[model samples]
Target: MKLVKEVIARFPADAAILDPFSGTATTTLTAAERGNSALSFDINPFLIWLGNVKCRSYSVEHLACIQDDARLAIGRVPSLIKNDNWVPPLFNIERWWSAGTLQVLAALRAGLVEVFGEPTEDRTDGLAWVAFCRLVIETSAAAFNHVSMSFSSETTHHEVEHVTYLYLAILDAVLASGSAQLQGTGEVVEVDARAIPKMGRRFSLVVTSPPYPNRISYIRELRPYMYWMKFLKEAREAGEMDWKAIGGTWGIATSRLNEWGPNSKVLPEILTDTVGRIAESGGKNAPLMATYVHKYFYDMHLHLSSLPNVLEPGAELHYIVGNSSFFGNMVDTPAILAASMQMLGYSNTVSKIIRKRNCNKALFEYDVSASWPG
Candidate 1:
């Protein structure tokens, strides 16, 4: 958030901000709070919903009513869980949550749908839904500190008192955090970043953090939430969404591996060399990693090429990206992306290393800042 604010401060007071990969809408919310109109885009429906919920205006009366509705929903949980129709996708209820806990969650889900109705584009019910999602995670047996969702060996007892107390606390926090004045108008679009140019809208500033080229799949991390929210009804649907994401690895098919060729003219030589080394490693997963790295740059190339259409002359772009190490080979993602931007006619393209972390040695995060030629 500090970094977002710093970048936004560099632009003029009335500069329009665009975040093409607005993960949790942090960039959009920051821009709005600073009195700048902002537009955010994310391909994931759940993320888009979350972004909208964070940016939307809500009344204290509506929030209080939601709390009351949640309390009533908790009372009806036992009966709601008996239907057996609310099972999560690709999951056995007993594996992740206690049977009693799952029942309470099922009831909560049903109650939210009944009280809030289906989520609309305006997302009037989004706050209630987000609160419900928070309850689902906080009450579950999954270890919150872990990178992936894994059930803890020790069981968690979730009685009515515990569940309702936690739910209400979370509800209050969400409301309080969102109570600030939303100074600027904001919009979140569910679309691919590559297609932004086609929208034919121009912005003075673009701030985003694209997915790193690491093999970690965000789809896997988001599966539980997506299933609970009904954004994905089955495992196959989850896979489809993963395939559409920028740097996805979990659901990529073997046939699509060859679609992105071995070399990219726009990317830096360091990236090409890393892909070559990974491909030559001869490990079972080597080819897959190679293809993923190649495709990452290819997609960025297309995204950079299209930026000129939507960015005003002299528009500034700040991309927060990270480097990755796969099979002991480094892929300098920000450097490669900066190189691609320069190739696409962006001026003053430079990558500044912002922070370094000791992740399996050293991993660096960078701010790849550039400008469209005026």
Candidate 2:
């Protein structure tokens, strides 16, 4: 938020913000908090739901009822355990939780279903936010210290008393965030960044962290949540979801890449050069990784080329992107994006080193700033 706020403040205070790759909606939420209209888009429905949950308005009475509803939901978990061993429809589900913890989380899922019923676009998200927090923050063994989530060293965390206490704590925090005085509304759409709608909507700023060229697939981190929330009903759906997302190369998607050729005529040669280096490196998964890198930049180019049509003249754009490494070869993602923007008619391009990422000493996140010509 500090980064997003800083960039947004540079533009006109009344400037509406656009985040084409609004993953967690950090930019949109920050903009809305500051009374700036925020329009965000994502290919992942779960992320879209999450962004909406963070920015939507909540009534005081509704917040109170959510707390009561959550308590009622959690209390019903004991009888609803269904032998305390059922797992989600996810494949290799044990990798996410130990038996005891999985059982408790499963019961909580059933409880949420009973209490919240089916989720609709206009439904109250307070309890759903609680369940989201519980799943990601409390029960899941997933860790995000690295570039992607890793499942290791996750001890079984169970006990109805502890679950109850944590649920209450999370509910309070959710209610608190929902209680903020929002002067602007956040509109989150489940759509691809590559094809943002030209719905007569023109934004003054484009603040987003488009997925880095790094091979980390966002879907890998989201499978646990999507399955529990019923966005995904089968395991194969994960790979299918990733395939639709730009730069996605997870299950089934990886194999699908083998059949993919570059969008050669439109993309610059630098991308192919990088892919060639990675493919010829003899590194593990080199071929697939190479294709992943090519597809990422190719998709980004398609997205960049469309920006001028939607943004207001002279609108500033800030992309928080990161460099990636395949084997020992470093891919300067910011540089590639800056060049792409230049070709697409954006000017005043600058790539500044923002922070040294802790994941790898050589990897750094860059503030790639540019402006669409007036």
Q: What is the C-alpha lDDT profile of model 1 across 141-200, one tens digit per residue?
A: 777432455678855768866776787788888878777777786778887876565566
Each prediction's number of clashing residue pairs? 0, 0
User: Candidate 1 overall Cα lDDT vs. reference?
Assistant: 0.77
Prediction 1 TM-score vs. true: 0.92
lDDT of 2 by residue, 40-128 (tens): 99878778878888888778888888888888888898887766444568776676777777777767767877888755456765455
Q: Model 1 Cα displacement at 168 (Å)?
A: 1.0
Error of 1 at 295 (Å): 0.4
State the number of backbone clashes in model 2. 0
Off by over 4 Å in 2: 84-87, 148-157, 358-361
Clash pairs detected, candidate 1: none
Score each candidate by Cα lDDT.
Answer: 0.77, 0.79
TM-score of each: 0.92, 0.92
Question: lDDT of model 1 at residue 274?
Answer: 76
